[model samples]
Target: MPNPSDYIALGSQSEEETEPELEEDSEETEEEQQEEGFIPVMESPRVLAEKESKNGEATVCSNAGESGENSQGNEWNRGDIDGLFCPICMEAWTTTGDHHVCCLPCGHIFGFSCIRKWLQQQGTTKKCPQCNRKCTLKDVRKLFASRVVAIDGESQKRIQSLEAKCISLDKKNAALIKKEAEWKKKEAEWKKREALLQRELHQLKEKTIYLEHLLDVKPRTLGHPPSMGGYCVPSLGSEFNGQGPFILQKELGVDGARLFDIDASSKIILMTRRLQGLGGMHVLTKMSLVAPYTRQDISLPTGSKAVRDLHICPSDGSLSLFASLGKKLSVLSTKINNFILAYDLPAPAWSCSWDLNGSHQIYAGLQNGSLVVFDMRQTARPLEFVNGLTSNPVHTIYSLHNSTLPSGVTAVLSASSAGICQWNFGGSEERQPVVLETGNQGACISLAYCPSSDDIIASFRPRIDNSNEMAYSQHLLTPAIGQGVQGSHVHLKRFGSNCYQKLAVTCANVNDVRLPRSAVMNIESHGCLFASGDELTGELVLQELPSFTVIQHLKLRKQPIYDIKYVHDVDGGLLGCLCDDILQLYGNHALK
Candidate 1:
């Protein structure tokens, strides 16, 4: 009949007054309640609505008859009535019912009837079922509400912090995945490079082993003279048949001498010289190899320019053949001191040579890489005019007449910057020139041939890499006699079966100026000998053939030798070294 709050206060006061009797009969009542399963008597809906309206917490519904539906809808929508159930009985509690929701001082809530029974079962030691707080039936204060809602501010803040941390962790994970993918790509590239390098290393090892086998077997089969690590080891005594080293017999100082050739039969040397104040006229200076060393200057025709190459007739020493930049190939009779034969050429001639097998045959190399063959029998025109492999000037030409080659094969060996080629002009069928492989040994600037040994010596200038403009310019401007210049290479090769086989190589101070000439001569007492100029010391270096053993270094006047000639006769041997300013003659002591 009274209000819900007044009824709750009156029930609490009566329960406190009857507490002693309830405790004395608590065990028996608890057993009976457990068997029957305690059921709380729920209050009517009108009373609950009245209590909720008085507390100012009830929602206003349009229809009072739908009050029950509105309360259920509110509980479902607010989602705060979940904690309004009794813990022990697991059922919703009523605000004014016998099993009302109540709380201990420690804030644990349970049904009032459930707490009373729970404490009565514990006898004198009554404590809260949820928090173990010491309490009795009087301490259970009822909650006067239809529904309960709690707001925990710290729990809300903790949830927001956890969501932010999840977002940060997701971004970090994405970055880590991207970095792993990039590392995988880099690792694949490195693995590919490693495989390629391994293949190259294996190929190099095979090549090295093959070369080592050749080195061990080749020297034995070729009957090459024994050498100590690519160096000739000479015996203790004199290297030149106990005559001691060659001594300087005579030195003729001549200005403007460019190239020269020796006439062993006549004991004379013919050199090309430019006479000063003669309007750049070039002449032949003749000198005797004997004691007084007399010199005679013979003038050429007005149109005869500076001779680029000079060679005496091998069969007849009285005649000399020379190529001049005046576009003329002329033959001079040393006896008459005049040119008796001259052939007009299409281009400037660079080098000339006479066929040793046929005295009537002559060959001229031109600046335009053309070989002009002439027969003395017909002076009107050349017998054959052929182009070389390249347009570079043919700086050297040598007639090859060896019996070991196929019969009726007359080949002319020529060398230019394009490399060495052998032209066959005396076969039944015309054949193209064969290019002999010299194994990438730069530009072939000069060549020396030994007919008896079937050996050829080629001098090379360091190859100019066109990609490096500065280096190419330096190569062009560098002087021929400088010490620090990248010197040159001299390779010794044997000619057989229409091919050339490289035998040995040596370094020299050869340069690309004036077409310096080197010589290979066969001496019965000294085997074969090779002579070349050493621009570094301005000396003529003499070495034993094939082995390249240094026999002597004849000191000159510290000038680059333009030409070297070795002449051997019944009397003795004579070596001639021609420089820009002087001509040096060295002979054995017997001849000296």
Candidate 2:
């Protein structure tokens, strides 16, 4: 009848216990003394728990310390955390790591794997499993060091060596510098090809899902159905509850979320791309923040359409779409060509993805210091980016590619008004930046990761609070204004979540002026399908990620367009789109 989490809260609430709970806590003989006079020490999480970005009053206990006071070993890492040696067995992890590791909440180290069974047999209360300091997370590790491991282990020297190797490996990678020029050209070409292929492939799949209409119809034969539960039942030739003579309805639409062509059996993790705007540094507008509303007259030929940011479902490669037409985030789905949500944004959002944990649902980074994490389970209002930002707005987010790092360890390494800062999950540690050089500094605008090669591509610029639309670039830096820099120093942070920290940065491009925040948003990882936009001109630019010189000039389509979608239906194996709202269905036998 009781809630389990409530039990976890209660069970975990041993900041201190009654002398009464003592017999219940017999494990602590020394804890009795500490409880009377010991000061608190810092005890870090064995691994940080899953937490929301927001923080509030914690479950306060009487022992809560005042501000600025550090807990025991809170200043860990200065000395090896695994330095203390066990006086009982006198070695690093006397037996197995599990037989005796540290317990969180109250940092006492113990071999409960042994004491637990010992306690059960005697029907005794567990005091301090170690020195019984009446365990609180703050003093636990210290108690363990003082009691469990009175003598230091030989691990100190080994730890120092390991730490040194880790520090050295963090450097040694100049491969990014060598590949810079080639990567620039290759990125440009791939952009075009990826855009076209992703669009076309998406459309083709959509057509197949609804293509049953393309088949010749045959009349149905109906007989007694399951209606005659216990009796003989006649079968119907119709795919529905019918007989040979009746008509039936064809299949349409999908289940859950939207009109998705997703496979219920799919197990792959899909990575979708969607955004509201882009940011750059500009003399006209100190911070070049551009979204759906900031349009310009670039003087395009007739029929040159602008493509909006796309909504893709990475789970099954199925996609829904959203674009801006009359200054709103339009929802492009199979049911409607443009189901527009009449909403306005401070600046259009640039890009978004599922945070590594898949806990917060989606994290969307806007042009300024405005990143938002939307709970996938709830779409009412997103947890705005500014709420979690301490330094600057998150410009772009990269999914950390690592198996060594735990989930939610790395997040949107924001390129804000100031510099780069990682939005660590909850109150963890801050991420170090491998930002662009000083002169070439501003907010980062875009991010793309090449799985083929281990490179995360990004773009940057300056602040964008005051923006002017047309003829904006001509404005010069005022004597006292336009503090934003050109930012020739955008570098890629490699293995950001690795234990062996690695850094890879981009080369100087003093003259590579980043364009004003535009719709040019997505970077496809599978070597094809790129999407960019001219937000001001309403032109959607689609291309493919190419590798070879010959593959360079490809586009998802030759003509500029406004929106697109990609889907794979149950019947239609794979489909992609360029501009069509309806799916032109076909059979598997039909060749493209």
Candidate 3:
């Protein structure tokens, strides 16, 4: 290891003395060179010269002297010296010191003292120590600054790219923040709307509770009077020794009662009545048949508005089926006093009935002139639907258990405004209904069926003249003997051999100026008796069946009678007559 000072002194000696010293310096290992903090120049001067000449421009070294002098007039600071060093000593260059910053004509930078000493020791040739270019002491230029800085073109381009990337990232971040704010605003609005809806729901529930309470307490003052002035007389042809069979037992006044059904096993009558505050909504009222006759009002499920028809299940006394104007057929459990099953219907239902043949089948008569059949075992949908002969509403339906029909055939009798139709099922693959011919009495308004007698009684309204020619061409036409009568007609017929044979027909003063009225028939040991409301005298008329002969007249109010039901059990016979204002119960005097 030779001393660094000896190498610097050897540069000024004779050529023969310096040649061996130069070889020794060149033989130093790369590790030694790096340890000395010396960086080798990558580009040769010849290559730089060719590149400059091709561009038709002088080398940067040629302009260094002029640039140095021009820079003296501008302000100089320490910041201008970033990343600048002298190539000869590998040390930082200063502004005003013995080893100040300077550049040779070859554009190579060094300390001023280092370059001057290098040129003097090179004798008269005075070549550049870096590029071997001939130069004198006057060719050396001094930089006028407190510090020196070198501009790296590649590093400056890299920093510009990084700055542009940072700007793009900032824009993306701002967009994400804005989106987050918008989502938060939407969430708050939804929460507010939810709170409002919850408040509305609570208010509706309170209103429902109040309305229910009003219905229960408001009708207590309307209790039935002790008597409604009813009387019974002996039948003209009966074998009762000139005494009537039935007498009034009690009267129950249920305000707003529309329809009712009696379950003998449970000894309760289920009736439908409108709510006080909510007139359009109707619910069930259960009344006990015993003394004191305790009553309970039951609220129906939502959407079951006005019930059109109600009936107790013949097979299961605890279950009752009803049709509603709400376009639903619902089965309610009287034991639990709640709706157990419901079915969607296409149109409002007018009547419903259970199969009296001890099957799981049930039937619904729709207002659209269609009959829907359902099996209690399958609740998802109806078993089948049959379209009626006319589009008029089927107001009455009954399941027939006649022994005269075929063994495999099951029959259902339904009556509408058009006529009476017997629907037969299970006999053949294609079962079609047959319309019963009853000599065209009038529009069938109501129907009643007796299982023991296999008899059907249908009431009719006077026929209306719908022909256009008759109204325009009539000059003087005498009406038939009973054609111009204002009252309705009642017909008794037997159903057998897939047809109806007329048994009796009589003019009745009932259902004349009113809507359809219901009638009932009861089986007695002597004979079967039929009862209906007589609008002319405002009385209940009891007539012997198959003859339509009047037996007894029980006086009632002038109000219309909407429904009647009769059932006989171990407790003898019970008769329930529902009028607009009161419900009257009659019992068989002979059986009691």
Candidate-wise lDDT, in order: 0.67, 0.32, 0.66
Q: What are the per-residue Cα lDDT tens digits for candidate 2 across 376-410?
A: 45556654435434323343454443344555454
What are the clashing pairs of model 3?
81-148
What overall lDDT, based on C-alpha atoms, would model 3 receive against the true structure? 0.66
Worst 10 residues of 1 by lDDT: 3-12
Over 465-526, each residue of candidate 3 has an lDDT whose tens digit, in order, gives 78322222111111111222344445556656476677778887644323445555665675
**Candidate 2 Cα RMSD (Å):** 37.2
Which prediction has more favorable TM-score, 1 or 3? 3
lDDT digits (tens) for residues 1-592 of candidate 1: 1211121111112223332222332444444544665344465677667766677433212222234355555323222323434557655445554666678765667767777778778866666665555665655676654445454455668999999999999999999999999999999999989856754463344345434544554554366322211222256234534333465555566666778888878988898877554455577888776744566678776576778888999899999998888899989998989988999999988889999787888999998889999998899889989987778788889998856556766678898877888888766775878887777777777789887777788887676655332222221112343342344545556557477777777777765343567888776656777888776566677777677877766656536666788777777777788765666676644342
- Candidate 2 weakest lDDT stretch, 10 residues: 281-290
Give the number of the best model, judged by lDDT. 1
| Count of clashes, each model | 0, 102, 1
The alpha-carbon deviation from the true structure for residue 228 of candidate 2, after best TM-score superposition, in angstroms, is 63
Candidate 2 stretches greater than 4 Å from native:
1-308, 316-348, 356-360, 379-384, 387-396, 407-410, 413-421, 427-445, 451-454, 459-493, 496-592
Residue 534, model 2, lDDT: 31
Model 2 residue 383 distance off true place after TM-score fit, in angstroms: 4.6
Error of 2 at 504 (Å): 8.1
